[model samples]
Target chain A: MKFKIAILGTGNVAWHLAPALEEAGHTITEVYGRSEKNIKGITQKLYTAESKTDLDFTESIAEIFIIAVSDDAISEISDEIILPEDSILLHTSGSVSIEALGYSSATYTGIFYPLQSFSKDREISFGEVPFLLESEDQTTLQKLKKLAKSLSHLQYVVKSKDRKALHVAAVFASNFSNHMIRLSEEIMARQGLDFEMLKPLIIETLSKSLELGAKKAQTGPAKREDLNTLEAHHQFLNYNEQIAEIYRLISQDIIDSI
Target chain B: MKFKIAILGTGNVAWHLAPALEEAGHTITEVYGRSEKNIKGITQKLYTAESKTDLDFTESIAEIFIIAVSDDAISEISDEIILPEDSILLHTSGSVSIEALGYSSATYTGIFYPLQSFSKDREISFGEVPFLLESEDQTTLQKLKKLAKSLSHLQYVVKSKDRKALHVAAVFASNFSNHMIRLSEEIMARQGLDFEMLKPLIIETLSKSLELGAKKAQTGPAKREDLNTLEAHHQFLNYNEQIAEIYRLISQDIIDSI
Candidate 1:
């Protein structure tokens, strides 16, 4: 099931995916990127992959070409890359659709979106990371399933619309949650309090919520419907109108949910 | 350093704190609650404590009494409880002030607020849980510090105003973060997707944010300024205006923070 693979774009997705693919027994035949620095960055991780700074992949032995670039660049790069005939072409994006590839040079075009946030500095295991897989045809989908299973046990065949919903869900689950901590950090800074003091509470609350399910794990003045504490908090935060608005809306949401 | 203690409430805080204090070498002399079931529930966890369903503590020999009730009940219960003279009285509330005790029967009044979300079903170690300690007098503050140090390493002598700020910050960090996950769960349900699929992403994102600090760990369409993805997500969420409003406010906050 191991196929020769060529990864395009050396961004966060490509930086992580290329090494993970190689580690999963896939042979990385080539690493291509417009930036020489990024190409060198990814090529250093592979044992036998050659680096290419151009879109030329006509002579590539890669059976699967993965374009792990930005959404805007995906279509442009898909139209430009000259993959071998009958090869499977994939792009790793949560928002972009399979149709965006649109009858490319490759016989099959698909999406290989990893439903997790990736930072180049943090090392992550793909074992539990969900990979949303889709293809233009059934045969290409089976190939993707094989590849995805090798890296992670969690793989789903989602359509473009569902994939888009998942993307928005990720925004809430990952990005919005992180920003909540940022807002807390700002509040702490205003009090001359160290952000470290809130770390244990943050970690425990999130862990407990995940364990007991978020709906069951909701706590605080909002969930308790304590008007005195809620009023006191609002009065304290009245100096910052934006933060106060957020507090009011989100607290109302929690109360309404309850 | 060990002292005799009486807990006046059989709530989540009392359930966790009584056992933690007992394990730290303190003697739980008495447990009090209006509900016999709750009194029995907490008394079972202690070796030497007697359960009381009445407010009769005039003859009690305990050196320290803790009011681990709701914020509204704190003042009423503190006033009604006829504790022995010269005993230290404490209330475990993040928002309530020490002055609320207002020269009660006990010679010393203080706040022993453990800044964490506690549940009766969960077993939480107090070692890392920060205890925000405050008292009416310098002498009582020192005693509160000693008691806090015995239970946890992270004990802070925060004034009432700073503690109020911390409480609001906690609402954002713990409660708001959990709600974000709840919102994500709702979004997943709308798409007929399993909420479990987003668990890995949720855990990893929060962990990364904690490790690198939230500002550096932020990643999403908003952070990237991908208007295509942002607009697509907005259109997808147009079915619900409240969620869409939340989406807009949080995303704008992230963009502004960047």
Candidate 2:
């Protein structure tokens, strides 16, 4: 059965999700945000100009309402989500739990967290993103699993706690890793080094790390404990204390990890 | 003119470089190592049994002898290099300077530091690895540049001091970014999560980081300063102090970076 779904929010997640669900043959009846103008771009992609600026969502009929707003906004939005009886309400947030949607006593509530960053301008196939589905109710969980199954092959039935753990891991994998490259750019920016030059090495090392298993793939002066090279690198970073400290700590961690 | 190359060491760099150079039509006349038996495996791929267990490289007749050895071994092996008069000698080291090859009086020395981590078992196209070439003497630098240009399009003429800086930046880009993934793996491994689930996120974030510029591409609670999610993650990691500490430090750094 093709489920009728309504989408809430006009951010990155909603932008990607709206088109993805519509393309998958699900009917997205309406898109809601604080301002209809804000979600016009996303709703237009669904070939439907049905957008509403409503604090309390009324006069909407859909089997599921996906709230893809920010974590802080989720609670207030859920208060506004007065969906029909026996229908489902879900939030696409890795950090926020299913309990955040507790305002709807008449509907089944759940989580449908896609574990990847979404950008409004950048297109990503929904099928490629890992969808983490979770709920305390079996019926709601099964409903989510079925809906998620239609979108991506990479689906996981995770508990709220484990999902939280995965989210933390993700922050490390994505956020910290990106910061490391930022620092790399900062260091090279000093000597007028082109960022393009470092791209291949960054890509190669990531692939190698995955293939060899992270532990086995570890290399460099820190992994080798070449104090000579390590010292040389340290002295070079003497002008920047924060970066030097990070280098020292991470290198020490790698050594200690061994 | 095709350079006749003698590669010293049978490690990752030597193993990849020998075949890459040979395929590019340079004559790989001999493969030298501490033990001939060790290099036999590497040399067989070159369709030659020209393996030499030479403590003192006295009889090597090559236009270029590329010492792709360990940092400490570079000095000792440089002492052993008794190549033809005015022939090119180079050590493939990021940290070790051209001065390390000062032990050789009969040859003009330089540096041919390939800037990616190589695995002996994993075949890498030499053209893909950035070759950082450096030489004090003009003639030797030109000769080294010519040989390097034949193998890779990504070539840089760097000074010894600046090259060391590049090496340090590489540690952050490749090594630390890799360790971030490793930590991600460790976190997920606890809950028996499939590493494949995280691969898409890792790849997407890394690409996005490069595309948007790292500072601009950064996302997560740290970037948002979402203390609720950050505190929840911290509590989840309380049992593992080291990981928790790393998490705290890196998150703090990301927030500070903004």
Specify the highest-lDDT model's number.
1
Q: TM-score (0 to 1) for chain A, all models?
A: 0.96, 0.96
> Mind giving the per-residue lDDT tens digits that candidate 1 earns over A1-258?
998999988999899999999999999998888877879998998899998988878899999999899888989988888888899999999888888898578888888888888889888899988999998699999999999999999999999988889889989999998898999998999899988889999988888888988999999999989887888889888997878888888999999999
TM-score of each: 0.98, 0.97
Q: A257 in model 1: Cα distance from truth in Å?
A: 0.8
**Model 2 over residues A155-211: C-alpha lDDT tens digits?**
988877788788888988899999999999988999777777788889888998888
DockQ for candidate 2, please give it: 0.79
Candidate 1: tens digits of C-alpha lDDT, residues B142-212: 88888888899999988888999999999999999999999999999988998888899898999998898
Which runs of model 1 end up more than 4 angstroms from their true locations?
Answer: none
lDDT of 2: 0.84
TM-score of chain A of 2: 0.96
